[model samples]
Target: MEPSEDTSAVSPVTPPPGCPLHSNAVPLYGEALAEDDTERWERLRKRFGGLAPVKVEPEVAAWLILGYEEHRQILRDPHLFTHDGRISRELLEGRLRPEHGTYPLVNYRPNALHNDGAEHQRLRTALVDSFEKLTSTRVRAAIEDLANDLIDAFAADGKADLIGQYATWIPLLTLNRMFGQEDRHGYFLCELMVKLWNGEGAEAGAADQAMVEYLTRLISDKRRRPGPDITSWLIAHPAELSDEEVTQQILLLIAAAHDPTTHLIGNTLRLLLTNMDLRFSLAASVIQIEEALDVTLWQDPPFKTLIGRYATRDTTVAGYQIRRGDMLIPGFAAGNNDPILRDADGNPPHAQRPVSRAHLSWGLGPHSCPARGIAYQIAATSIATVSARLPDIQLAVDPGELRRRPSPSINGLVELPVTFAPQQPLARPHRAEPAPPAPPAPPAPTETVERPRTIGGIWDRVSGAVRAWFGV
Candidate 1:
């Protein structure tokens, strides 16, 4: 490493006083790791400090990074702590495999999110350049329109499950628009995702293969005829990404970007319905949409833990023995709650929650999420549209009854049932005069690059849970 920092201080291999033995390591997915449960996290931290040994799956061990500085140190050094999962000892030893639930997450993939160094730059550049082509105004307009369309579907009903009816549909349709695919295509893909996430054994595997075919068709079309969509932009970018790279990035967008943003909306909505102060502030114009969303992210973000970060060499972090192939899972929830990063007095509810504060909800360092702006645009517009249309909406069930999804795939409430005075939907006037012609679509990709002789194809690792619990 460069100059060793205080955060990198290692203790004797004999082990720290309170460190739990490997056989007694805590469970990363257990109840204590719940997003809002600070007491449990505190207890775990008191015993294990920043680097807490935990079992990711049955018999699969890893360390959950709980200290903010320790987490930051690891993420900042990419060469030492890599995103690529191929070097994982568990996978190499056959303790983890593609068939396991955690495999799809930590398994090696040829995408920007899972690579490092110059290779990562090439793959990541393709995504950044493509995203840079989007116009904020255009994106916001699309999100607002899509939001209204989804709201209009259930506005006449006195009650609705916001999660199923609103949160899920917004991301699905918005992503479809971004991908330059038809609404029918997104709906079909969503059906397959649901099957893949919910189906088990051969059924889940079958659904996974179907998703592969669906995306393959999409990529093939873009290759033949370029368009304004992200898919087309990637093909035309200077990075010279292969067809497989383009597909993986798109899959990552759908899996990583879609679910968290969906859940952020759900989490914000839950606060609005349950927290009186937030609702009052939002209705009274005391806080903007961005502030409201920020509150949720700080307190109950879209995920409890970020993806796996593997060690490139054997090292010790806070007295935890980290082998060359050892994996460190960023504890998003725990890191956000790290007292060192927060006020000594402690965090308050959403009403008093600070805005624009640092948080690990989107991960950290060079590998942090690149789609924060787009994700916020879609989520903010979706929440605003519903609030405007149904100002009187209130939670139908007791706030205590809202349950967190126990699945490893999601991070927010199970459902958000709400009731409102039946309201008239927005009306559009029809006239004999036709509307002005629509603007032209993005020009076909003019940037030239050599195509790979062999365009690799693979299955998408997006589990069915995104479909079942489509929110964060």
Candidate 2:
């Protein structure tokens, strides 16, 4: 593809004294850490051009690509900018120690996200085939059921933290169900997942190890008794992935699903509640839930910056020199707000050209998110279910006081406190009470074990066993 003239060259500018580019201690957490990202990014763009240098965690300096067209070009050509996790050339050369908080981010793993060429294709194919089982209708129904059940837990109280009660739990429960895990195990996994993302010290390391062991056992169980779920589907795929490979794939899927989906729901809800025009449009049936989600994707993507990509060879991007083994971070949030794409008032220039769905929120090229459609379905259903069930719901806290979680990769709120009119629980007419059992029966001869009478019964037993074994 031809490069756009707008991104042809970046004007040269000298970095100010003690700027992020010149200092090793300056941290880069994207707009989430900025009080006002729009003004901040615009200032950075002018000062250092599009490819500005900055520091990530553990005092590692890297380049932050802030141009939309340049970001797209780098993402599209993975051969030049690979997604392998070997970002720190100094560490590989025995020049740096592995005692930093950012060690995990640069550690290589045998998964699609950390590979290129045929290996990436093989791993990604297995994942894509397994995800195909999650049809749009199935995903929508599953998320809706999970969302409603979560809301029901706090509905009578008329007030709840939407992030804890609804946004976070819906994806956790849905993903757990898809992996054929019980509610107890699901809850435990959710706790560990959060710790893995936000915890510090030995506690975080322990949580990470525990998660791997649990998933390893789950994969073994699936191999022994295959079922109609994502894990089983992956095991049965033509790729014939080993237990270790399957475990890595499962971890990737869960991690990828959890934060992004949770944030998408939270961010969209924030927009709907805070923007009167959007709420009015929804009330008047002037816009659909999908449009609301699109707006959120364009404005507040869950991942403000795509994780680091390493340069394969010396190259020039947007007229900026890039050295081999140098780390390049794609600015998804900043690129979305590129001056070339936005009007003077900081809105998308939709009137001048067709609105394209080419946003970099999901990345681009070969390594882009394979479950993009399912993500959209999950977010849309979640937002719609809550909004429809509680039309009077509103933000409980002042919008100005809301805070973002402290993470280098994720862009999400710390909490979303919301309130709604109190209402009674919905009546469940189909639920039937179990009949009373007879007096104790005689002991079975030779202590013979009884098998479940139906598929549902078998699933319940298996789920119970897994949950019990996990002590969840």
Candidate 3:
């Protein structure tokens, strides 16, 4: 269906000044909506009802799906509410330009997150197959080991910014290991991920381009020397994906992995440290870290709102008219706390809620997160490891003083300042040096070699080549 040209379908009510949905207001993409999301969502719900039209960019307005059922309906039926939208088309047609101050969100590329039909299925299958290697047992062990290593770094410091030192590093390290990346490239990927998340237009685009180039090199190397890693697995998959396809898949995987996992770890930790009821439940063994993770997912998912699902045709959702080409966002956080799903006191009725994972935190439908189990394992294990080691860990500052990072795509803490009792670093095994090679068999009996050559010349050449190859 062609896009509707009718503007009257949108609410004619004039928004008051400073309202996010107001036509004259600045685009709401930063800390304002994310910092205090609960109150802000409530206000938006009250003002605009469920399907509210809000500005994602200065001149771009989209309907934010705030109702629980409405959100689910949109997700369930991709035919009516599809992921393919005008922004993506514009991006493909080279009509979308990136300014230094603009967010590079709608610069769509063909990946699982931005596609539909058979193409999405193909890309998603490759991604799912790659992640299948990360079994729950393996993920738990790796996360636990990485978490402890991070803790060991600051265990004796008595105070540490858990967000910076622990939550942030754990996922990055784990992903790097899974991708078979050295520490240098892993750190570089982390830097670029942050730049893409927080930087604007030119900077963000450059970071993304750099990531593609880096991943291309990484994929090329993996092709030459396949290893027991995700990248190698992708390269060897029966799909026979080209270099660009493999690079895009890996880029999407990395992008999806880092932000959500980091925030999941951070948000779950925040709950455990600050929510006394949750802490007591954990201490009494009434609830596991996984339950706390569920609560956090339900209450404060990492991404408050998702981007760019345009209506395939003119339709009405929850009493609001959705014209074709109108952008629709699934308010995952808001929908999770929709009034219809909550009790009279405005809280989730835990007892009456369905046993199924109904929360939109990991999203819904065919486009839902594929690596959610691994994500959960990473988060749960990280929290458990920290709790076991730092039994007395507490927030260093008042809860209200903490700030959320400014981004439309994420709801994460800027820093989680935490204090715990100082303790000795855990002991780790030392690497054993290789035994000297039997003096080269006494220079072979038949060879009457001259004794004038320098002793370390051959070793130097070998070490230099190794260092050069590995970029060490």
Candidate 4:
């Protein structure tokens, strides 16, 4: 597909009446966007230069920035391209209807993701400072312990779904630890988050409410009794955060950190298993998982699209006139494969792209992901842990048989089935009761742990054992 700027790549489908979009707009959210995204990106780029107009919903139109330089321009300039959606033109003009089910997404909140200027600085600094306190050496040790324990729960079975048993748990368990909660809360919160994201009908809504209530309670408890955790750090920050503000930050951090980090680990695992060069090197212990992680971030970013960065005012980007309130999304995956970074045929330079460090997956500017530093640590640690524990692991099914999760927003597999050499399960963490104040109590009772009899409940048993650390 030779690059063209003919402006004739209009879709056959038409936008609804009163839709404030261009004539050539195409649907941005669809199976095509997720399934054959590279092809769709190429087709759209050939006609629309680096930025293409797209219909977000049937009635809403927005710009999809697909060029590397275009991404830098939009992401780096806060004055022109702000993160705040409250000042959006469609919104102010009454085009963004409340019943459309997306108003809440665009509505302004006090969190860092939705704010600008000093407020963003304060909130982001609190997060950065908190993370800095968690030195990499300490963080890695904790993650290594968590990964090893999780592996112990299922390694004896000889086979397991990496996604269900491993990849998915690291982020949730880590979040609970960071928030200074016990294993029980992680189990409770993990179930709630899973239901919130994957449950059906009223189940999703109920789970969301329950999670909010739980977090609120956790924050209140932390205020009364501070601990050496992220929540306590936020609560005691110089910013003097209110309970609601702390709650907002926790919600933002968790939502931003969990899925992306989980998928990053999962994708990296898939690459190391399927790519022969990396596979051989990994088996020989000569390959750094960070390189594999970089490749995954460039090729299969955790998030395919970050929708709705609105124009603060009328502006021209890449020679196109922009209207105030027009929405734009920084196409991270597309920008990583922009023509400038690609060959004359518009294919990414496979030999060089992975080694190059220009991917926008972590984003840019003030609104960039605050959790990026720890995300790398968690993903690399998780991958390293798996490789160390299951050196001979191989895919249970053909690579092509692996299925993606059904969401255009995320690039992740539904499950990763693998087989490895069975090993003796490690001793689970156990809790012991304390002595009485009056007299030496009958030797403090030790709690006995019951391992799951079947592999089906490995996640619950292993993850539930985290309570031993907190004495909960």
- Per-candidate TM equals 0.84, 0.82, 0.80, 0.83
Residue range 1-472, candidate 2, lDDT tens digits: 1111221133323333664334532356444354565665777688777777766643356788888888888888988988775644433433223344444455566678878888889999999988888767766777876676676667789998888777876776677778876555666777776565455557666766666556766776777788878999989989888776777788787867787898999999999999998889877878777777777877888887755788888888777667676678888888887888976776683222233566788888999999887788888889888888898999998999898765555678889998899876555453232111111221223332232222111011122212211111
How would you order the candidates by TM-score, starting with the best?
1, 4, 2, 3
Which has the better TM-score: candidate 1, or candidate 2?
1
Give model 3's TM-score versus the native structure: 0.80
- Greater-TM-score candidate between 1 and 3: 1
lDDT, candidate 1, at 398: 91
Cα displacement (angstroms), candidate 2, residue 120, comes to: 0.4
lDDT of 4 by residue, 1-472 (tens): 1221222232233434654355667876544445477888888889888998886655556889999999999999888887888776556555554444344556566678877788889988888888877778877876877787678778889998998878877887777788887655666766776665555557765665566557766776787789999999999999987776777788787767667888999998998889988778656756567767888888888887776688878888877888877888888878888878876666664345346556889998888788888898999999888888888999999999998765445778889999999997655454232111121111211332222222111111122112111111
Q: How accurate is candidate 2 locally (lDDT)?
A: 0.69
Instruction: Provide the overall lDDT of each model, using Cα atoms, as 2-decimal numbers.
Output: 0.72, 0.69, 0.68, 0.72
The parts of candidate 2 lying over 4 Å away from their true place are 1-26, 29-35, 93-97, 197-206, 343-346, 349-355, 429-472
Error of 4 at 135 (Å): 1.8
Candidate 3 displacement at residue 84 in angstroms: 2.1
Per-residue lDDT value at 223 in model 2 = 73
**Which runs of model 4 end up more than 4 angstroms from their true locations?**
1-20, 31-35, 98-102, 283-286, 343-350, 428-472
Off by over 4 Å in 1: 1-21, 29-36, 200-206, 344-354, 429-472
TM-score of 1: 0.84
